[model samples]
Target: MTNPVPKTAMTMREIRHQLGHPVPPPGVPDAEVLPVRFVVSSVPEGHNARHAYTINVHYRGEGMYSVGHGLAYADGDGAWSYEPSRSGEDDEHDADGLTWIAAHRFELTTALRLARRLAPTLTVRGRSVADVLADGSPTAEGTQR
Candidate 1:
């Protein structure tokens, strides 16, 4: 699938600045600051295969802290074809997943931002965000970060 968000490459300093983190003065290295990374994945077979897209926000030193996913189907057949023409897997589907992703370019940017903001909160004490969300508030269980 075509990346909904434009692929980006930024240094730690640039990323911190973009995310509103404090920027160090000149000559101050950003080694302690984690570099921000963006990732995307799309699979045509999931429940929302028609519009399903995954967004991942990662920090070099901090690991992945945020993930956002959604399935947004276009009206009618949309602009994508699931034909798999090159690979000849199916006539109905665009054999190249990139074709489908390219058609859903509108939804990626927001997902990236949300993932970035929530990334820092992904790790609470030692448990995962999924764990907390699935099990209820950590404080409710007497857990503290």
Candidate 2:
């Protein structure tokens, strides 16, 4: 069996690049971008400690964005789009004008439910929720209390 990709923390800049979001040039107001914090932890289940995936999703925003999670497509020229779809057809899950801000808001139902469990515990030092969330991991920063 193929080994699962090891869990490595990724920065917003890196994740954004992978998700087809715009990466501003140096000194170009990059702070305005919203970020998505995701982790897919492996939990041992059943006998012999086999691993099961536990996905975590966290983000901070004004709650006015759209996220599409589905199949992704690319043409011969390399341009591509991704949207939620259970059907297997080109243009079946197509979307347009989605921005980086909106992408962070997108969460699968299960992901959202899991996130809510952890969300209450994420605030730190009276800072902006977005800033705390953007710091990237729960253990990365937190208050002693």
After superposition on all CA atoms, how large is the RMSD of candidate 2?
21.8
- lDDT (Cα, 0-100) at 52 in candidate 2: 16
Off by over 4 Å in 2: 1-30, 40-52, 56-110, 114-145
Q: Kindly list the per-residue Cα lDDT of model 1 for residues 1-145, writing each as its tens digit.
A: 7869867889888888899999998897655554465654322222221122334443413132323333222212232223223555665564345465443333334435554444434333475445544553334235532
Report, for every candidate in turn, its global Cα lDDT versus the true structure.
0.43, 0.40
User: What TM-score would each prediction reach against the true structure?
Assistant: 0.23, 0.20
Candidate 2, residues 1-145: lDDT per residue as tens digits? Answer: 9999999999777788899999887667666555565543322222121111223454545433222122222222222245444343444333322332344344445445444443333333464344533544334124211
User: What alpha-carbon RMSD in Å does predicted model 1 have with respect to the real structure?
Assistant: 17.8
Name the top lDDT candidate.
1
Q: Compared to the true structure, candidate 1 yields what TM-score?
A: 0.23
RMSD of each: 17.8, 21.8
Q: Flag regions of model 1 displaced more than 4 Å.
A: 1-36, 39-91, 95-99, 103-111, 114-143
At residue 141, give the lDDT of candidate 1: 34
Clashing pairs in 2: none
Q: Model 2, residue 16: displacement in angstroms? A: 27
